[model samples]
Target: MLTRPISEGNLLTEHNVHQNYRPDVDGLRAIAILGVLGYHAFPGEVPGGFLGVDVFFVISGYLISTIIFRSLEQKKFSFAEFYAHRIRRIFPALILVLIVSLLIARNVMLPNEFAVFGRHAAAGAGFVENFVLWRESSYFDVATTLKPLMHLWSLAIEEQFYLVFPIISWLAWRTRLKWPLLVAAIGLISFLVYVFSSPISAFFSPLSRAWELMLGAACACLAPKILAPKSAGRSFYGSSFSILGLFLIGLSFFGSLTTSLFARPVLINVMATLGTALLILSGPAASLNRLLLSTRPFVFVGLISYPLYLWHWPIFSFWTIIEGKSIDLTSRVLAVSLSLALAWLTFQFVEYPIRTNKRAKFRLATGLAGFMALAVALGLTAGHWGRHYDANIQKIIDAWDFAGYPEPPGAFHDPKYNFVSWRANTENEILLIGDSHAEQYINAIVASLNSSADRPSPQLMFYSVMSRFGIPQDLLNKIANDQAITRVVVSYFWSIKYGSPKIDYEIRCCGTGLFQTVGTKGGSSPSENEMRSLDAELEQLLTALRRDGREVDVILDNPFGSDLAPRSLVRRNILSGIQINAGVALSRAEAIERTEPYRSRVREIATRVGARVIDPMDSLCNDTGCPAITSDGFPVLKDYDHLSLSTLIHHVGYLNFLR
Candidate 1:
């Protein structure tokens, strides 16, 4: 998230970045970046943590707009010069982090994951990550946490604003229009677009987001008239505005989630933007500006904030992927600490040395241009390479069928099926319903009962509420209408429907269970109220099914946390080779423990609903732990969780549950 440019206030120094440097602005920069860091590392701890990006946008607008205004007034404005400063400010640290994250990705990422990283990395280099992500993301697809370069979306918006807006401002200022009023008008329109436009446009459209930055630009354009030296330095209005500014910025932290769903054009986002503007106009002479906001520690963070932002996300994302769970508090802290240290190193060794040297401008331009070329090549090559690799991964996945039953098309047709295919089985005695994880075992179930009198046919829900609620009424009616259907096997990954607090919300859809009546965002643990609602709904559903004389069985969630799977017990052979977090084998108790709270809770719900609990570990685990690898040594879990069909059929007792 660094060579994310630092405070716009500091940019006035590019004619010299250090000589005219304002420490108070650096403090503000520190606040914005820290808020972001806190939000990423611990989202529930800071639900509105994303408002920090809005804060940065305002600071950038103020600083860049100020530079342009002064140059234009003196009749010496130059687009070449403005963009040169941007390159110096943004390119060096950005390239450094891109290289660093790619190195890590090559070492650990699955072929598919690495390919996605490459694609987004290329987008980041081109300053269009926002568009790529916008195009890629859907309401139910491409979740934010899954994207390693996700935070770069804001940077794309910021950089695009820099590229396009200054020219418009220059033209408008050259006209009879008052510069401040024109900018404010544009800001008002943009804010309206953000509020009224579709959410996709609001999230990714530069037009919608530009207003936050323009608010800063307006303050810069009007500052000289409204906050003259004598008036700013000694006026009581300066101190009062500065104090109000600080309060509003702080308020977004506590009261943002309720201020509409998207993290833009909302009351809290506007508050943070206006807050930054007020502080900038308050003049450095304002006491609050100099005393608390300009403290050395804050300024220090600001100094390295760009690189810190760049490094933190990839580190946190990769770590979460490897751990296969929500980052515990300790791991989150460690990731942040490592990010700070690496950022400091990158800033000192890469950004500072190159950006500060006037004589190095030619060298800086050449280096960045070359680096840009390399980043693009690296991205394309990685993607091409991973594409080949994924072909093999898919082939392996294709082979995950049972001994006798052939795997159906991974994707299917039919409106009733929705996304995946759902054929009424020759028997149609058992209806398998849920998301993708629920589909993983269908082949195994089919193989076990291929010739049995009662066969389990899959009715894929594919996605949770985002598609349809648990087992759509249509599918239920189909089952109810089938006289041959004597049993209903309700198996789903409950965690997918009801997100787990154990996983970060950015990575997950939501923590609320599928049965929950009240919906909430993806940051905190599921509320007791939601859980109660879920249980009540399940009870009612089960009651209805029993009244129809059909036996019901609910499969609990599978134990997750195997991103570091394929674990080998013998880290060091007799020859003493060192091994890290390699292939892992977990016990039965630990497997059950891993699925806890939700696992136990699901078990309770099943008991209450008179449904039998079909726990997979009964077959996979005995008195000992569940071995991650089979005796033949193939890893049991394919990715983080879902067992391959062969593993489930051969080892996990797919036949027992059918009866």
Candidate 2:
């Protein structure tokens, strides 16, 4: 299996078609896969488990570079053969996973969810999943949970790199330049970008992630020269460096290491990459490496790591969807056990057979083509289904959406105001100041104004809100200067804005700056101390507004129903052509129960500041339930959290606050 416990400094360990397969490398893959599996299935157990991907990059680079360099050096490298090998190695298991995923989603997921899945499936097939996800959100963003094909992004990145790297290697060989040096140079440039580029682009872009791969390639390219068994450098190459490497890997796995990037970044990745390279270079000669990593169990896992990675995430994601929340530990363990079984079976029955059968390569190619067709057809069918769902959603939207009039040239109608402030007589305009949370209720406010026959046409002045400020400096500045605005209504999505994944805001007082708040998302609510501080911040804003002689009304956040979009719920009900209350997505009682903390906090702060607290939860919802769809079968919300303009427009009399 392994180069049987090679003598110290005698295991330069070259691998080719004729060479013994390194079971130790497979063992290292085991470590990486475990890290990934642990992290995904139980992040609390393995927060740094993602570093396994870094380990994989290094292993992949070294293995690939070793093959390419050895072939090129011997003048036996072929592009056709290389790509054919790639197709064989990659597609069989992947196609199986895709087929199964599509089938499951078609039966279980709503039209919106399935539509998203279908789009990602096509992107995954094209090896553009990373780009598609990058365009959507950060890798670690909450949006990742819904996309069953999310992990395919890495495969896409690796495949995209494979397309370009061979040509680069070939050119270096042709030019008689040192391949290692060329790769190192390219890697250095990429590393710089990794460290300094915008976190999002750096994290997702192939151009930035290339360095991690290059590091492995560099290791392989220089293996013969630097990793050669040295007669004298026993401690340097044997146990000492290998131990340090393992330590680094452990540190990364435990997330004990200080380095981090956007909760997912480059420096932490470097630790795993470097550690994997060192351990790989140590070969099977190092006693510790041989004892632990070259074992059968570890090697078996390594063999199935690729397929396991593919199957695990989707299983967890779908389980979450089914459970209507995150999977519990028992479920996670069950999912992992099932994933391992599927992966092993897939590896044995699917991957090993097709990968080993050299003569049946043409058959492999034909099967791949057929699978591609199936994937395309699945994607097309999903999209076509989605279009019908969208058309229904659109008809509902048209009937309920309030903004029908076009804006006059040169005076923009801010959607928040629903009408241009300057175009309308603004001498007695109501000032609205808040983020998208406030913006969510624009239609409700407009509909109330439209029905008030006795009141002067209610002109509104809108100032965009930032979550970082309860009362923005811009709003304060506008109020200090403008006489047209007398009243200020504050609204925001308290749950989301105050929730984790927040940005740090720097408040400028002098030449220097201090961070006022950092919205690092950890959970739904803040700590008691943080809440007190937040309460104080609201009071400060209200007091300042009152001092400026402006009437301030703080509208309480609406009840958070099922966060799934209304169309999604509609699809769930209508997908089966059966309207069931059990499938309504959210009940008013549940919404009210959840809104307690928000309403209590808002009322507490409003009372302290002597400001009017507007609670819309009662107006929009009742004791029975908050229906997403209206009596006429038109949906109300754009999604679960935000109120649809049409819903507010049609149901305006609910606003007793306007009285």
Candidate 3:
């Protein structure tokens, strides 16, 4: 039987190693796990449910510290045993989850996607999921929704803490000093640095997250010394305090606190630390501990929390992938039931036996290592198999002669113009400027112009399309000098240009002083500003390009509401008399209507600046409407309002203006 007042430790309350463990501590885990689940299941229902992770950090600190302090105080600290227990507890379930997920994923994922899954699995096994995720989270990629192992980042943080904290606690015990104070200070500093970086970086960085874990460690160090009956503040109002703390936690979940609100990420770290401390510290108070967290239901959920957390996200993610859409109400309910059932089974069959039995733990670890190695090998082989298939597919595409030739150098040949493929004759020099939309057409225009042997090879150069106007400050300085021999073509996505009524132009303007500073430093000719201020910069660029022995051609932006669905599917649906959603079909149709107003704006600006506006609205829209998909079964848009590569190639003739 476990004894009471197990040992006299610095932080351990008078209770010995054999003393009864607090059931309410598990109840707090119950609260944390449930809050997180509720948030993921129905985001709007509990927006702050993410705070549950904070609560977990605090509880972990309390319990783990209690155990460590007692062992150290009794001069029985065993690093080997501690680590063994940790490995047994954490890795078995995690490896099992990853293996199962990889097996399921291989059946349906694309070869490239499967390769990605394998990589994540390997990374998770290596305990660096957070680093993998941090590197990948950017606007250029679909970062968040894709990774099934994304949630493993928190566990990784905890594991890291577990590794470092034991060593630190051991050192502090040997020194008989307040070494935890030094640790807390370091954690605070690291958290500050994390908050200073990008939000995603702060979210993933181990250094940044260390404070939350350290907060728990500190509480563990302090709890015993402070809670002793002889201590000055040892008056027991445990039940009331626990109730108040739980209420605060609940209140926190209902509030609108978000990562976005924190000016510094460290602020959130601090808040989580404080909140967790209060909750954990109040847990063992008999009056509160008995009534609140001791409830059987709360304790039961806490027991199964680890398995439930592990299983939920993957099931949800896979369901979304297989359904090719989000889950509706019934599906969500079913998903929940399935998740719960799996959690219960895993707990009963796997976690419980391994945890309670020493020999069973050893067997379980051996079996898991074998299974994981087999799964990884199989996953790798599948990837190899898929790559071979893809290479063959590429060969077929080459055989079909779908792969095109490369274009030559000059303005049109510049890599900047490669995406757009703008073609030019020997008689004309073209300048393409604007955002990505304008830059995208350079290659087509250049290729189309080059295709004609009769036409003089025209030169083309594309400026930064994302620049606020045709002229960024860097280019503005250059254009004032370097009188390049002649014709100027300005092609930009004018609809999304700076000074548009919808977008704030000031915010859009970047790199304005770069060109001017370059000019002042004798880097190039002094750039003449036709429009002295940002508002008139576009018109100024047009006039300046003309003044310096150049003619200007401004390509108008394309239709704005293109969908990603294949054009062939859309046309086939129409022919088959199948009804599609009115919202999707009409959005494109409405986009076509907006062209006239956009055209008028372009014409008004072009007329004033003596530039010609090349509008492709007529080519894109038919009498009935603007088609989302092409007749050949290609998606017109890659995303909400931009054309896909195939869509751009099909409309290569739209570059006639460049010729």
Predicted model with the maximum TM-score: 2
Task: Kindly list the per-residue Cα lDDT of model 3 for residues 1-659, writing each as its tens digit.
Answer: 11121111221222223224666777777888888888778777776677788778777666666667777888877776566566666676777798788766665454555687887777676667788888876433342444666787878777777888788788888988564775577567876777677877777887877766667767777766655653222245554556666666766665544445544434444554575676666546545456666677777777777888888888877665554345677777787788788877887777665655545544655665666576556555556753223332222222211112233455234443343324443334555566666655656666666666585666666665576664455665555443542555565555454223332221121211110011111122112342234436666667776675456667666665323232112211111221222223334456645444445655677778777667666666667666655565444554434454655666646676555
Question: How many clashing residue pairs appear in each of the predictions shown?
Answer: 15, 6, 45
For candidate 2, write residues 510-561 as lDDT tens digits: 1111111111223445677787777787777777776556677888766544
The Cα local distance difference test for each model comes to 0.67, 0.67, 0.59
Q: Candidate 2: how many backbone clashes? A: 6
Tally clashes: model 3: 45
User: Candidate 2: what lDDT?
Assistant: 0.67
True lDDT of residue 79, candidate 3: 78
Instruction: Tell me how far the alpha carbon of residue 279 in candidate 2 is from the true structure, in angstroms, after superposition.
Output: 1.9
Could you estimate the TM-score for every candidate? 0.73, 0.78, 0.76
Candidate no. 3 TM-score: 0.76
Candidate 3: 10-residue stretch with minimal lDDT: 511-520
Model 2, residue 644: displacement in angstroms? Answer: 3.1
